[model samples]
Structure formats: C-alpha cells, structure tokens
Target: METIEKRKWSVNSVLLVLLFTLFGAFAVFPIVTLIIASFKPAQELMRFGLNLKIDPALFSFKNYAYLFTGESLYLTWYWNSLLISAVFTVLCLLLSSMVGYGLAVYQFRFRNLVFVLVLVMTMIPIEIIILPLYKLSITLNLINSMWGIILPFVVAPLPIFFFRQYASGLPRDFLDAARVDGCTELGTFFRIMMPLMAPAFSSMAILQALFSWNNFLWPLIVLRTNEQLTIPIGLATLLTPYGNNFDMLIAGAVLAILPILAVFLFFQKYFIEGMTAGGVKG
Candidate 1:
C-alpha cells in the first residue's frame, strides 16, 4: 500500500510539473514573439504584423541603430519615463507607507472611518475624477510638466491599503522599544520599522514603478508637448494616419521593457514574501 501511494504521488507531481510547464510556455509566447519581431524590418512587420515565422537572413541591426542614431526623440521619451517613474515610486512609497503605518499602529479618533474612506477611494475609478483632476492640473500650471504627472497620484489608494495591511502584521513591541530608547517618531519609523518592512517596500517598489512607467491616460491628458511625452505616448505617436514607424516602435518597446524588468529582478526576492505576508496578516 505504501509503494502504491508513492507511485501515485510521483505521477501527480509529474503531471503538475507538465501542466505548469505548458502554462509557462503560453505566458512567455507573446514576449518571445515581440523580441523576434523587433529584429525584422518595418516593411516585414507591416506585412506580417507580429509572428514567430520569419526569415533569419532578413534580420539586421538597423532598427536598433536607428533608435540610437536617428533623429527620433526616443531617448527623450525614455528619460522622461525613467525620471517620472523613479520619482513617483519613491514619493508614493514614502507617503503611502507612512499613511498606512499610521492607520495600522495608531489609536486615534475616527481611524476606522478614515480606513473605510480609503477603501472607498480605491473602489472609485480614476475616470470619474479625471475631469476635475485635469482642470485642477491646468489651474496649477502643471500641464506639460513632469510634476503634473507625478504630483496628482503620488499618494495612491492601493499602495496605502497594501502597506496598512502589511504594517498591521508588525509587532507593537518594536514601537515600544524604539520609544523607550528615545527615538523620535520619525526616527522610529525610519530606523526601526522601515527595515522590518523591507519586504513590503520591495513589493510596492516594483508595483509602483511598473504603474508609473506604464501609466498612459493621465500623462496623455496632462502632457501636451512632444518632448514631455512618456514612452507609451511616444511609441503611440509612431503610428499615425500619415505614416507608421513600426521599426522604431517595436525596437523602442523592447528597450522599454528593460527598466521595469531590472526593477522586478532587483526586488523579486522579497516580492512573494511580502505579498503572501500582507495577504494573511491583516
């Protein structure tokens, strides 16, 4: 009976691995196709769209060369995206985490009400408030500025909620210890709690960076100038009624993936831990 049970377990494990392998291939298929498509000429892309079947002989470095040497404003757009994402991620993490930590740790009047309001804010779609936000941006003279993009959604609801939940799981003993040691409130947070919350920080860093990097609608509405456009907006302009620059578009897209990919890889070790801990803790 034991031998039979072992055999059954082995079979199940093998089947599970095969299933996951199939799913992994499916997930990776599009990215593989995009990378392959980047190497081909714009004419070939316009003719074939995106596909894996292509003549290797036709592939060349011209697309990549054009990205660097050509007069296209690809580099400017890339710099804009990187700067916006970095600043936004840092500000979002610091502010949202503090707000969340306060909610989780402090005993104050109407605290529950405040948290409920945050929840409600998360439920409310950005589309509903975008008009007011746009008007406000114009009033503040933030239009066509990077700060216009960064300032509006810096304290995003979702990250606040996540950080609150994660902070709730932390032990109050650390807070007491820090206070007893004569650490200031801000010092306590920075010195004592922030390190303990490293996993949460890592997880949110990736998520917030990804959001800022890929954000489209808000930036589109706020930034009017060509030079101020993010990568998504810039790449989108390549396709127009007059002509299409599929060569630069595809190549630019491939390069665009690198920053986000690097961020994920950097924080990946803590991501799963933070997510699982946050999910269960609060």
Candidate 2:
C-alpha cells in the first residue's frame, strides 16, 4: 500500500512538470519565431510571413546591418523609449509608493474616504479622461516632449493601490522603533521602510517600466515629430501606403524586446512573492 502511494505521488509530480513545460513552450513559441524571422530577408518575409521553417542558406546579417548602418531612425526611437521608461518608472515608484504608504500607515480624517476614491479612480478608464489630459498637455506646452508623456501618468492609481496593500502588511513596530531612534519621518521611509518594501518595489518597477515602454496611444496623441516618436510608433511608420520595410520592422522589434526582457529578469525573483503577499495581506 505504501509503495502504491509513493508511485502515485511520483506520477503526480511528473505530470505537473510536464504540464508546466508545455505551458512554457507555448509562451516561448512566438518569440522564437520572431527571432528566426529577424534573420531572413524582406522578400522571404513578404513571401512566407513569420514561421519556423528554418532555411540556413536564406539567413544573413543584412537586415541587422541595414538597421544599424542605414539612415533608419531605429536607434533614436530605442533611446527615447529607454529614457522615458526609466524616468517614468523611477518617478512613479517614488510618488505612488509614498501616497500608498501614507494611506496604509497613517491615521487622519477621511482616510477611508481617500482610499475609496483611489479605488474608484482605478476603475475609471484612461480613455474617458484622455481628451482632457491632451488639452492640459497642450496648455502646459508639453506636446512633442518626453516630459509630456512622463508627467501626466506619473502618479498612476494601480501602483498606489498595490503599494498600499503591501505596506498594510508591514509591522508597525518598525515605525515606533524608528521614531524612538530619532529618525525623521522622511528618513524612516527612505531608510527603514523602503528596504523592507524591496519586493514590492521590484514588482512595481517591472510593471511600470513595461507599461511606459509599450505605451502607444498617449504618446501618439502627444508627440507630433518623427524624431521624438517612441519605438511602437516609429516601427509603425515603416509600413505605409507608398512602401513596406518588413526587414527593418521585424529586426527592430526583436531588438526592442531586450530592455523590457532585462527589466523582467532583474526583478523576476521578487515579482511572484510581492504579488502573492500584497494580494493576501490587504
């Protein structure tokens, strides 16, 4: 009987491993296809579209060479995306985490009401307010500028909600201990609380960076100049009524995935922990 139970347990573990391996392959398939597609020429891509029918003879570095050496604006767009994502991620984490920490830790009049409003704001779609936001951007002379994209959504509600939930689970004993040690309020947050909240910060850093990096509609509305366009918009311009630059487009896309991939890999260790703890704690 014991032997049978042990065999059953081993079978279950094997099944779970196989299930997850299948899922991982599914997730990785498109990326693998895209990478393969990047090496092929524009004519092959136009003829075949994206696939995994590997042709060693057709593969060459010409697309990448053109992407780098030609007068393509790929590098400029990449720089713009990297800069915007980095700045926006830092600012959003700082501002939103502070607001969330305050809401979670402090006692004040109408505190519940303020939290309720934040929850409500999260439910409201950005599309509803985008027109007003655009007009405001125009008024502030932020159009065609990176700050125009960064400033408007810096204090995003989702991060505020997430941080608040995570902060609620923290021990209040630290707050009192810091105060007894003569640490200023700001110092307490900067030194004591921030380190304890590392998991939360890591999780949000990836999320906010991904959002800012892929963000399209807002940047499209705000930015008018080709030189100032982000990666998505820039890549899109390669396809037009007059001509299509499939080689540059696919190669540029594969390159564009690196920064976000790096951000995810850097923070991935803490991401699952933060999400699970934050969800359960508050």
Candidate 3:
C-alpha cells in the first residue's frame, strides 16, 4: 500500500510540473519573440517577420542606439510613463487603503451600502463610462496634463475592495491596545496598523503601478501634446499611414516592460502572502 501511494504521488508531481511548464511557455512565447525581434533592423523585420530561429548576422543594437542617442523621443515617453505610474500607484495605495480601512474598521451607518457601491463600480467596465470621464476631465480643465491621466482612476475600486478584505483579517486587539495607549485613530493606522498591513500595500502597489503604466486609451484621449504622451501612446505613433518604424517600436515595447517586471519581482512574495492572508481570514 505504501509503495502504491508513493508511485501515485510521484505521477501527480510530474503532471503538475508538466502543466506549469506548458503554462509558462504559453505566457512567455510572445515576450521572447518581441525581445528577439527588437534586435533586428526594420528592413529585416519587414522582410522576414518573427520566427523562433535566430541568426547572429540579423541581430544588431542599432534600434537601441536610436532610442537612446538618436533624435527619437523614446526617453521622454519612458520618463512620462514612469512618473505617472509611480505617482498613481502611491496615491492609489494611500487613498484606497484609507477608504478600505474605514469601511472595514468603522461602524458608521450606510457602511454596507457604500461597500456595495464600490463592488458595483468594480463590476462596471471602464469602456462604458469613458465618455463621461472624458467630459468630466474637460470640464475640470484637467486635459493635456499628467494629473488628468492620474486623477480619474487613481483611487480605483479594485484596490479599495482588496484593502478592505485584507484589513478585515487584522486583529481588533491591536486597535483597542493602540487606543488605550493614547494613539489617535490616524496615529494608530499610520504608526501601527499600517506596518502590519505590509503585504496588502505591496500587493496593491504592484497592481496599481502596472495598470497606470499600461493605461493607453484614457491617456491618449486626455493628453493632446506629444510631450505628455505615455509609452503606449508614443509607441502607437510609430505606425502611421506614411511609414512604420518596426525596429524602434519593438525595442520600445521591450523596454517598456522592464518597470513592470521590476515591480513584480520586488513584491511577488508579498503578493501571494497578501492574497492568502485575506483568503484565510474569510
């Protein structure tokens, strides 16, 4: 019986490994193709298109050089994206966490109704309300500004819901203890509870950062100036009726993913920890 069980466990482990390997390949194939294509010149990319097989003669750093040293405004676009993403992520986490904490910890009337509203907001797709959002931005005179991109969705409902869930798991004893020790409500949150919620912060930080970094359509609508354009919009400009700069476009896309990779690598451990912690609490 023991030997049979051991054999069964070994087979299951092998199957799990195989499944993960397949999933990883599926997710990574496009990224790998893009990176390889970024090294090829526009003429080569146009003629050959993408392939798994690589040729040493076809690969060059000219596209990278053009991005950095050439007259192209790739660096400006990169800076714009990084700045917007960073600001949006920080503000989102701060505001959303506060709102979440209030909903979870406080016993104010209409709390459940407010949370239901947040849930409903999350269910609604942004595409449905984008026109109203654009009109609001125009009315507020926020168009063509970086704040225009950052403000509308900075305190997003998803993060609020996530934080509320995570905050629910926290011990009420800590709150009581802090109150007895003469800590103000804000002081307890910032000085004590906030430290204990590190996993939630890290998880939300990574997600909000990635969303802000990749946001395209809203920014494109709001920002009319080339100087204010984010990475995605800037890359889109590479393709026009007049011509296409495939090399630079691919290279820019490849580089654009680096910040997201960095954010995930930094917070990946906390991301799993936060999700599990919240899940177990409920």
Candidate 4:
C-alpha cells in the first residue's frame, strides 16, 4: 500500500513538472524573444533570424532610443492610446457595473432573456459589424476622432458578464439591510454596493483597459490622421516601406505591451479572484 502511494505521488510530481515545462517553453519563450530582440541592432537582428539570439556583443540600445526619439512619434502614440483606452475603460466599468447589478440583484421581467442576449453578444466577433458601424460613425461625423474608437467599446459583453457574476456572489442581505435603512435603489447601489464591489470592479477595468489599449483593427480602419493614431497603429507605422524593420518594430511592440503588463503584475491576485468568482455558486 505504501509503495503504491509513493508511486502515485511520483507520477503527480512528474506530471506537474512536465506541464510547467511545456507552458514556459511556449509562453515565456516568445516574451523573452521580444525583450531580447528590443536590444539588438538592425543588421544583427537580421542575422539572428525570427527567434531571439543569445549574444553579448550583438546587443545595442539604439532600437529603444530610436523608438522614443522625436522622429519616431512613439510618445504621441503612447499618450493618445493611454487617453482613449482610459476613457473607454472608465465608461465600460460604469456601464457594465450598472447593467450587471440590475441583472444580478433586481427581480425583473425578461431578466434571463436579456442576460442570454448579452451572453450571445459576447460570442459575436466585432469584425462582422465593423463596416456598417464605420459608415454610421462617418455619417455621425465622428470619423478620425477618438470617438471613432471609444463609442463602440461602451457595450462589451464580457465585462458586463464579469461584473454580474462577481456581484451575484455578494451577500443579498446587505442590499436588503441598506433598503431597510431608507436607502433608495439608486442610493444603495452607489453607496453600499459600489464600495464593496471595488475588488471585482478594478479587475474588470484592468481587463477592459488592456483590450481597449491593444485594440488595433477599429482604430486602423477609422483613424486616418497620423496625429490621431493609437500606439498599435503608430507602432505599425514603423514597418518600413520595404519590409519590417524588425528591431524597431519589436521595440514598439514592447512599448505597446508594457503598461498593461505592469498593471497586471501589480493587481494580478485580485484579477484571478474576480475571474473565478462564478465557478461554484448558488
């Protein structure tokens, strides 16, 4: 019996090691390649091929420097992307939270039907509606403006689902207790629920912020002006007329992804909890 138990423990340990080993090779390798690529010069980068090369002498910071220089316009992209994503994320938080609260807390007519619709909307890709949406934005005179990007993002279904799931897990008695103290429905939501909901709220905001920040296609189709472009578009502009200038391109990619990486690293624990909130609930 003891021998059999030992064999089981050994098997589990080996499986665990293999799982991490596989994940690291796929996930860590690409990011490591990107970070290492940022330091290589143009000629050296070409010799290294697609994968990241490991060489002490081949490294240079020129890619990073060139990225920030006035000629690059990276800072303009940075600021514009930051502002647009921030505004869109804040709007999503407010809208998703309100909608989620209504669905999870209120006893309403057609509630399940409305929620099913929202769930269905989540499965639909944004690509299908882009053409008509673009035409509508053009007719509304919002083309090439930040609104071109921000307006459509206001109703993303996942954030609403995330907020609803987390809100559902909270104790309903607290909401009832607030009502007993003469709080209006609006008052209870803003005063009691909003404060308690901050952990999940921040997590969802981070997710939406990253999505909006990394959003490429919508801004690419709608934004035509150089000054109006977001970082993803701006970085994409770095692609040479001939071919990708791999060093500069990767540098811009690094810059584009770093802010959200920082945010995730800081708030990761709460993010995981929010994601798992709906797994086993009544």
Q: Each prediction's Cα lDDT score?
A: 0.87, 0.88, 0.86, 0.83
Higher-scoring candidate on TM-score, 2 or 3: 3
Query: In candidate 4, what are the lDDT values of residues 14-132, reduced to their tens digit?
Result: 99989999998998788888888788776766776556566788777888898778887778888999899889988889988999988999888999999999978977888999999
Off by over 4 Å in 3: 1-23, 271-281
Clash count of each predicted structure: 0, 0, 0, 0
* All candidates: TM-score: 0.89, 0.88, 0.89, 0.87
lDDT (tens digit, per residue) of candidate 1 on 189-222: 9999989988788888877788788998999899
Residue runs of model 1 more than 4 Å from their true location after superposition: 1-22, 273-281
Mind giving the per-residue lDDT tens digits that candidate 2 earns over 37-113?
99998898888887998899998888888878748888889889989999999999999999999999999999999
Error of 1 at 118 (Å): 0.8
Error of 2 at 138 (Å): 0.6
Ranked by lDDT, top first: 2, 1, 3, 4
Give model 4's clash tally: 0
Model with the higher lDDT, candidate 2 or 4: 2
Q: Which regions of candidate 2 are displaced past 4 Å?
A: 1-26, 273-281
lDDT of 3 by residue, 119-209 (tens): 7987888999889999999999999999999998987887788888889899999999999999999999999988988878987777677
Model 2 residue-pair collision total: 0
* Cand. 1 Cα-lDDT: 0.87
